[model samples]
Target: MEARPRVAGIVLAAGKSTRMGRPKQLLPFRGRTVLECVVDNALASRLHRVVVVLGHEAEAVMPLLGHRCVTTVVNPLYGEGQSSSLKAGLGAMTEETDAALFLLGDQPLVTADTINLLIAAFADFPSPIVIPTFEGHRGNPVLFSRETFPRIEALSGDRGARGLFREYGDDIRSIDVRTPAILFDLDTEEDYLRLLREFPAV
Candidate 1:
């Protein structure tokens, strides 16, 4: 088989986090803010590039990111919804990148190894979409092939790539990962506190 093209790591950090009251991406987690942890983890992965879509206090988050070997894309239309940020990030991808590993900023527990596993699965079996499922529940940081880029770019409203996956079910491939971290995301202050208390710092 031909060598699979490289993939970009797209981290969506443009949500308002209304439930958390503050930008959940900037919330402290294990000493570092949530967005920092997510970006650091993505940088550690073997992705072609790491793109962060920032908005909803983009200035604050941008400074925290500093000079990392990652590309930052600001989503001015972030207020529109998550789909806007997703499209912006995907738009920044290079043609060399055949796919993208989409991650959420609030998912601080998702490890680089989990991301690598997903990428490896995609390389072995090229699919339009590669999703990770634990037990019976499916979760985020989904992998999307370039084939679905058009549909993803055309997405609107509050819905995300999930809608695209459902629309193209025949092209979706799933891997049964045993890790539950895929399902863990810090959406509120209580959620963050619970995660800190349960997992602690490494």
Candidate 2:
């Protein structure tokens, strides 16, 4: 039998959360912390492995993820920006991984189904890059084939894989998904309140 391609899930949680006043990943949502929710969803997905890149408040956030089906990696240069965290997470992926799904830790609303859908889409196309789009807008938790890892590793500043997507736009396979969860992220006080009011029961 042919081997199934391995796909890894990467949760980027190393940000400083400067605008949110405190660590957004540690914020309580429904009974669990935001980072916990994100990690749980990633673990529940079909990805072969899940990795979380930690920084800023690693001490507090590290314990919360204890013994989950995920691996934790620290971004020593996290202060550099999101790209640094991306590099850290991708670097920790297992050698068998043929692709990787990159997720932001603050996007607690992103569900396992959404992630699974992206993985399924990648399995079908096996493209260099796969991005989820809702309506006409493109959003994260993007999946990239191992073919693009070299470019991804070379990313600098805060440009992120988005820059690589632009550079290799022709190779990007855009999958349209009907999920508003792609638009949710906890960046400000208003965003937190909106999440609380909208998903009070979680």
Candidate 3:
């Protein structure tokens, strides 16, 4: 039998957070910075590698990951948008990586179980894109197969991987996640407050 493809975790944290008026990744959450919490969850999962993409307030956020085991990559053109960070993260991955799970840094609610479950689904039914869905709603930390990496790298602006869904919708595999955290991300004060109120455990 062939060796199983290696799955890596990519955390997109380079956003400027203009709406939040501050770096949301540095915001306090469960004894650690918001970005740290997200990275930690990915660490606790089954990914073979983890990389955090930084831009905007990279100076401030990079310090928080000082003791982290994940590789940190800086996107010089982050102001151009999320695609820059996505490309930076994917570029930093080792050649052995077969697929990558893209997670939002502002979304600290994602659990390790969800990541492992996504990996499990990918193992059973590998596809170009694997998104988590809750109650018919799609969510992130989206997994992209190696075959689709070239197109994703060619992506420009803030579009991220949305365009891929349109092109590869039929080939996309959806894994049903039980938690709403997959869709919850902190952007403004209200979103952060609501996240805390809705998920008290965090």
Candidate 4:
């Protein structure tokens, strides 16, 4: 029997959160920091390993992650953009990893089921890139096969794997999911409050 492809969950939690006037990763959500919730969801998924990228307020965020069972990497170039954090996470992935699922730190509402759905799709379809959508709108926590790692590593600045979506359009697999959690990311106070109102139980 063929072995299952290994996939790692790369939580991008290194953003500075300038708009929110604080580190969004440290925001309180469901009795935990936003990043903690995101990491918890990743841990509950079918991923083989979970790597969290931290920046901005790394010292403060470090405490929140003390007891977690995930690997953490500090991106010194985090001020450069999201891609820096992506690179940091990728650097932490083991050589055996077959794919990576990039989860946003501020998207605490994204459920483990949604992540498992993407993992399952990657296993069946084996697309170079797999993403989730809701009601025709694309969402976060996109997965990229190992074959695309070089291209992702070539990216710079604020651009991320999404920058290559058009180039790999034909090979991309877009799975439609039931919840809009994929579309929600906390960038401002209003966004955080709205998420709390909408996903109180999360």
lDDT of 2 by residue, 1-202 (tens): 6567788999999999999999999999878999999999888888888999999999999999887878999888999877898889888977788998999999988889999888888888788999888997898889989988888898898778888867887888888889878878988999999999988863
> What is the Cα-based TM-score of model 3?
0.96
Q: Residue-wise lDDT of candidate 1 within 1-202, one digit each (tens)?
A: 6875698999999999999988899888789998899999999988889999998999989988878988999999999998999899988988788999999999988888989889999999889999999997899789999988999988898889898866887778888887898999988789988988998888
Q: Work out the TM-score per prediction.
A: 0.96, 0.96, 0.96, 0.97
Q: After superposition, how far is residue 166 of candidate 3 from its true place, in Å?
A: 1.1
Cα RMSD, each candidate: 1.2, 1.1, 1.2, 1.0
Stretches of model 2 off by over 4 angstroms after superposition: none
lDDT of each: 0.90, 0.88, 0.90, 0.90
For model 3 the local lDDT of residue 114 reads: 98
Backbone clash total for model 1 is 0
Kindly report which residue pairs in candidate 4 clash with one another: none
Q: Which parts of model 1 have CA positions greater than 4 angstroms off? A: none
lDDT of 3 at 151: 94
